[model samples]
Target: MEFWNDIAIEKSWKVLIGLRKEIDFILIGGWACYLLTHTIKSKDIDIIVDFEGLEKLRKKHPLKKTPFLKKYEALIEGISIEIYVPFYSVFAIPPEEIQKFSIQVEGFRIPEPEILLILKQQAELARKDSVKGQKDRVDIINLLMNSELI
Candidate 1:
């Protein structure tokens, strides 16, 4: 299990780097929390990208458009990328303003720790019974207790 986790963690970061190489994005969701709090490594990637960035990603990967969900989904190296767009994807914060609320970290962009906490709390509220919801809980507490953003 540990070995597989290490592999999963490695692949997650690799996908992040590869996505960075492919297009500009603001990292959101659990990975951003992990980057700040170092509590949990995310299983997938969640990012906010503009139309041009989305186009670049489309050129590299097949995108599944779920307009109802207001986002796109793609798979890379067996890891999932949930791509949210401005004015389309709804969140605790608007997608367009996500950039304004973010900060640059080691060449990637992530939301402010306080913003991340809000995002996580919203996510937890939406699905408080599932496995990922459980993760959201852990992330929320970690963000409050361990993250410097608060």
Candidate 2:
């Protein structure tokens, strides 16, 4: 997965292009944070989509239902992509909010600092594992340091 850290952004753009216009979603989690900080390493991609977006994605790819994670997941080009549908997760950030914080980078719409901070905070609290919680904390800090939010 070390190679993932080097090409994460490029790979993200490829995945977005593959999804095309049919999906309306925002990049979230570690990958999103990495885009901003450009210092973190993430092996997987995390996204949040509305129900309509989920349905649209279903047409193009095989998504395995992961009710446990409040997401539908797929492995694309060796990267695990987790797609969350706002309702089931404790982190229910609306698309409107996401749009407001979104930035277009290399043709991919990625979540900005404020949104990443919000999600990271939520993840820090929701994760029971100390390691995950700590990683979330570090992500929050990175976003804070690198973003224009300060």
Candidate 3:
């Protein structure tokens, strides 16, 4: 499987454009940041969408659907994408809060850098009970420090 860092910016653009209508929320991660700010190597595209919308999307795109709430990894024209519903905590973030700041991608707007940093930090803190806590912590730190969030 190709890592997120292995995907090109144009490929990310294609995927985002392809999925635009179905996407209610997109938290650009990994190499996707290049489209918004600067380029940085990242392993996976961490995306979140409204659970209800995702369910409807799954039903509509049955051929592309996977188990609910689990990472659905697939390659479309050689570009890898990882999809999943955000945890309740992440989803709990009010849309208004997210709307307060966002970046545009092909006419579709997504969370801004600061919001992304906040969410990543929340994800890191929430990982305390998980086996991957350390990795999450490191990722959160690196992303927060390097991204334009600050």
> Clashes in model 2: which pairs?
none
* lDDT per model vs. reference: 0.86, 0.72, 0.55
Model 3 bad stretches (over 4 Å):
1-14, 21-24, 31-34, 41-43, 50-56, 63-96, 105-108, 126-148
Query: What is the lDDT ranking, best to worst?
Result: 1, 2, 3
Residues 102-127 of candidate 3: C-alpha lDDT, one tens digit per residue: 77754656577666666556656766
**lDDT, candidate 1, at 127:** 93
| Predicted structure 2, TM vs. truth | 0.73
Give the clashing pairs for model 3: none
Worst 10 residues of 3 by lDDT: 1-10
Q: Write the per-residue lDDT of candidate 2 for residues 46-123, one digit (tens) a residue.
A: 787888888877887788997776668988776678887765644646655676778875555787777778888888
Looking at model 1, report the run of 10 residues with the lowest lDDT sum.
1-10
After TM-score superposition, the amount by which residue 101's alpha carbon in candidate 1 deviates from its true location, in angstroms, is 1.2
Best by lDDT: 1
TM-score head-to-head 1 vs 3, winner: 1
Q: Model 1, range 23-48, lDDT digits (tens) per residue?
A: 99999888898888777788789999
- Could you tell me the TM-score of candidate 1? 0.93
